[model samples]
Target: MPTITGFDYRRVPVAEDVSLNVAVGGSGSPIVLLHGFPQTHLMWRHVAADLTADHTVIVPDLRGYGDSDKPSGGYAKRVMAADTVALARALGHERFALAGHDRGALVAFRAGLDHPAAITHLACLDVLPTLDMWDVMRGTTAAVGFHLYLMAQPPGLPERLIAGAPDAFFGHFLDLWANDPSAIPPDVRVAYLDACRNAIPSIVADYRASAGIDADHDQADRDAGNRLRMPVTVLQQDWGAALGYDAVALWRAWASDLKHETVTCGHFMAEEAPADIVKSLRALLSR
Candidate 1:
């Protein structure tokens, strides 16, 4: 049993053949933690421990990423968000605070917009809205996210290519995105690699969702003039500032009551700077 400071880690079934490896601890208002791509619920080990003193932390490996069932479909954020909502309700939480990082942030965004009554507060770390994300990048900016283009390609090729060298494929981003490569530690790196290695198809399926189904959702929201109806907090690395984009203005178009800021850190903000993530989440939840 892998142990963190305050949580008892275990696996719980979220759907048939789709159990999520979850870490539940502490006792207070429930706060569900969602992790990004190439990572799992384990990514929230540190943040969950910090919140356990006053919150019942529910950290789950989003479908297809960790110990969860690597289903062939439903990688779209809307479907994934529904899975998380069902997982929370199954665990006896009707309403709770939600926070997610990277790809998980996209799920959080969908959950907030679609199920506003269920999420009390929302926080997204190191990402932009899916539609805004694709709209802003061009040329060299797109190169930083080459995987986006590659994974967006037809399914069979991306799957086979990534599976051929899963470690190298996943490790490339893990290495480049970490401010301190050593911060992840060796054993955790190995664990991350192992999980990523086994999940190539599902991971590709997830990115594929972003390219198609997820895009449709975002476009429909735009067409419907739908905006997030909750207090939304977004902490990102200022890809907008560095790549000549307007981060706040883009988010404002989607979130009516929004507080957006750029943080000086690598993409893995929670793992790289736990204190900062904690402070940011606390502030957002308080508001």
Candidate 2:
């Protein structure tokens, strides 16, 4: 896949055995953007480009995605959050704004809660907190998260099934979740599919970690009465109404200075609604 224009890409070591594929660009206050599952840092192309005029935009593929080295383990959000923070620090940023979509949002959530001093502002797109997410998955509603269940199973099965037809499995979400598929260009879609196909096992392991270790970490945080101290913004679909609960209320429990709003777009809001997402990030950064 080709690099984003005006951005320089590199592999930065964030741990003893892990290196992150990061793309850095722009100037001014630093802001690191993290991509979700089934996609790479490319998902942030539009938003990163827009923010580059006023902010130093750092885009990195989460540990198990994109060109990043995919180790078989350490997929927990806490570990992933450490990678993100370390990436920022490696780039000479002691504190920076952070934003993530889907799986990346989960990592950003952990980052904000665990490293409050390092993350000045946090934006999570289209995902509830890990613990709250599992709460909402019930009966028929859980059908929306079939992939999660499939991945959470003991490793071999999910890895085998996904690897059997990686592109079809990964591309299914790209087609189904986007409000307008065209928002993701043809080349971009191909790149995502290609990357996912090559990294099926690590990808499955990443999701698997979420169901097990990530949940444990989230529960521990909740038990400790921990909440995000940074300015928090959650842009999501109205899952609370769909699941018969209060959406904003659930977020309020975790964030003190929170701007929660429902957005009408596909799951890939950063690509589908770049302008709105950019505006939202700017507002969060300003806070």
Candidate 3:
């Protein structure tokens, strides 16, 4: 195992020509952590280390981010979720607890919905379902979420425009979303910017899927009145209170049994407040 100062990190092959950078530690039932946009598996460094004493931890960069293979297609949450499932299986686990942040949270949502039998529990940080997210953003709130529209633009344009200054584009969210700018250490911020700069096309493709294919999947589930069967927990900043949107109600509609709360932190809850995240996960798992 290659040691990175305080942590042990290694690359694991999840599929042919595709590998996930994973950090494993601790001992117990598996708990897989998925990181958000523009960030590698490193985002979970703190949280994973915290849980290692009591649980087996698996942290992976999503298919198109970090050290993971940046495949040209299949950026949809459903497909990305499958990659996670395969990764877990390849690592010798048939079932595991799962948690994700931002874009990764969307992938977790799909995994719980599409692969209910594979996920024992699901935790989503600072995100809502694609359809509910679209429904909640109206008027001024929509403006706050303008990135959705920008990224949803014709593929090449958004990618090209964002590529020009990837740091600025990715950093805008980090600054605006974090309640404390100091929450993200300088080195991690640089790593995030560098990764985002290189993976502009894949990042754009992931968002485009949300606007088109992901919307269709959410709508189909809504039309079918589908609901998640496992224990589900959602922790998010009060975007609803800030924008006058009913966040809990929207989430409850999708999760039959859920524990939803708004934490008094920024969008990057894991990094901003790892203690709260760990507390929430422990409580959710206990149930």
TM-score to true structure, per model? 0.96, 0.98, 0.95
| Candidate number with the higher lDDT (2 or 3) | 2
Order of quality (TM-score):
2, 1, 3
Model 3: what TM-score? Answer: 0.95
**Deviating ranges (above 4 Å) for candidate 2:** none
Q: Cα lDDT of all candidates, in order? A: 0.86, 0.92, 0.86
Residue 124 lDDT in candidate 3: 92
Ranking by lDDT: 2, 1, 3
Q: TM-score: which candidate is best?
A: 2
Better of 1 and 2 by TM-score: 2
Cα lDDT tens digits, model 2, 1-287, are 85778999999999998999999999999999999978999999999999999999999998978999898888999999999999999999999999999999999999999999999999999998888988888999899899999999996889888888888899999988988999988899999999999888888888888888889998998999999999999999877888788889889999989999899998999989999999999999888
Better of 1 and 2 by lDDT: 2
The global Cα lDDT (0 to 1) of model 3 is: 0.86
Residue 89 lDDT (model 2): 96
Off by more than 4 A, model 1: 1-3
For residue 104, what is the lDDT in candidate 3? Answer: 94
For 139-179, candidate 1 gives per-residue lDDT tens digits of 77688889988898987999889888889999999999988
Judge candidate 2 against the unseen true structure and give its global Cα lDDT, from 0 to 1.
0.92
Model 1 clash number: 0
